[model samples]
Target: MSATLHRLDARHGRAPSLDPMVQLVAGDMNMVNAAILDRMQSQIPLIPELAGHLIAGGGKRMRPMLTLASARLLGYTGNRHYRLAAAVEFIHTATLLHDDVVDGSDLRRGKRTANLIWGNPASVLVGDFLFSRSFELMVEDGSLKVLKILSNASAVIAEGEVNQLTAARRVETSEERYLDIIGAKTAALFAAACRIAAVVAERPEAEEAALDAYGRNLGIAFQLVDDAIDYVSDAGTMGKDAGDDFREGKATLPVILAYARGGPEERVFWKAAMEGHRASDDDFAHAVGLIRSTRAIDDTLARARHYAQRAIDALGGFAAGQAKEAMIEAVEFAVARAY
Candidate 1:
């Protein structure tokens, strides 16, 4: 983990932190991870193989951890938090599987995506299987409110996918439109993950809402940071290629912000890179230069920082403890993470 920070500093030039949140989260994250790992092993022949494909890819498991840690921070004392944590994670992984298929993506965290490795048909079916599994687990929780939250989030995620597909490769996509898409696709689940923690804790509605706001803003920050890394970070550090958004013709925050501030030459470059599918190597390089010259990266970082701050602020309403402190550090750490 220290190596990660060194790379971030040597490259994008981030500050050295006293405690990196990923590492802190890592210390105890695997306790909850075991629940998912164990559930993922249930066999039905090929179904096991399909599940292994995603599990072996070894994601950060951020969603589940958020649920677990939020519950702990809020002083919950029960085993239900673990199950709900797994439920949210299943939903998240299922979405990723479907997303890779829909976007025709071949890579994620530098590994072959499920659609790329298992064929799209298998990926799609496996994703459906996982979604069903998540729904079943949510039902086991036996709380209609929790069921409703997950169901609503799932629907929003589906809508977000369709919205992005409809807007794909279009230079006309505005900043507001992009935000709405990401808010639905990414932030909705995040908000539910934390809000459900409060529900399981049997906490008041006010506490639930505060955690929901934290998750929502933090999720937005996570997406913006992801978009920033898509342009700025290296494959080794980011676990994905730079210009991923570019290759997909996705009008990310930097691109949208840059376009809004570009001159005639920059505008022409933006149009060609986004709309004209056939882009030269020179076009990608020029787009990077244009983005760098405009301070779009700085602006995007500012927005991410704002959301991170909002997350920490929301935490203030909760009780003071290690979990709370870790949550604050985690929010800040994610904003400054190498990946």
Candidate 2:
């Protein structure tokens, strides 16, 4: 394990639960949940059915909580945050729907993926419907600024997906390039979600930007831990097959690092397994051995810790309180997932 992770383990024992952050915004979250169920409703039974299945599967609901907690941090007390929170969730859910089709996976959040149950066509189309509904919510807010931030994020997220597609199965993918991919694909929405809270609160540009920075760094850390854990986590723990990234030829950070540090024979192993999509159980075992031997997972967790610290530092300007502390704790909660 990385020294940083070791220190954290000695200090905290384990990752703090997200419950404190959830409790901090429970009232607002209730409103956001109501709006989510209400907005997801449609006359077409299939649309609601499919969307509801995924929604009912349950996620951490952390993104919208960031939106709510951020607004509270800025002392905003308006109902607009609720609608905006729901819209943020809709955007996230829509992306997950599309991503499952793209990744061709069977599980999400410990349940069968929407795409697996409803088929890709229904999943993709319903995802589009959610995208449309998100836009409608933004339009209802009547804030061009909100629309611009979210719409821009929506576009950048799609671009990030395409970027990942381009980089997939390419063993030569660089760390910098991988960071760029996750920044847009994952962090862009996080940045937008938090930024809008400040926007609704009419806070200063500095505060908005600070919150955006917090979310951006936190999102990056979150994805990095995700990549690292996928190498070791079980199907039950990770909610997807272990080595799914390898099976799909995804050039995530861990694989990229392992490839870079591996000997000539190991490089050839990665190339053949990735290119041919022929990673058998033995090949997977070998890959894990290489990753552990090279300290790739340790290094990946180290980088995630770096971003998590940056996320906490970004909240320095906020007053010390529940909102700020919860946000700070969120940084720990995000990075500690690797353990």
Q: Evaluated with lDDT, which candidate comes out highest?
A: 2
Q: After superposing candidate 1 on the true structure, give the runs of residues whose Cα lies further than 4 Å from its correct spot.
A: 1-31, 41-43, 233-235, 276-278
Query: Candidate 1, residues 16-131: lDDT per residue as tens digits?
Result: 34244455446456666776676665556666687777766767777877887787777777778777788888899889989999889998888888787779998888888888
Worst 10 residues of 2 by lDDT: 1-10
lDDT of 2 by residue, 118-217 (tens): 8999999999999999999999998999999999999999999999999989989999999999999999999999999999999889989999999999
What stretches of model 2 exceed 4 Å from their correct place?
A: 1-14
Clashing pairs in 2: none
Worst 10 residues of 1 by lDDT: 1-10
- Candidate with top TM-score is 2
Task: Please give the lDDT score for candidate 1.
Answer: 0.79
- Count of backbone clashes for each model? 0, 0
Question: What lDDT score belongs to each candidate, Candidate 1 first?
Answer: 0.79, 0.87
Per-candidate TM-score against the hidden true structure: 0.90, 0.95
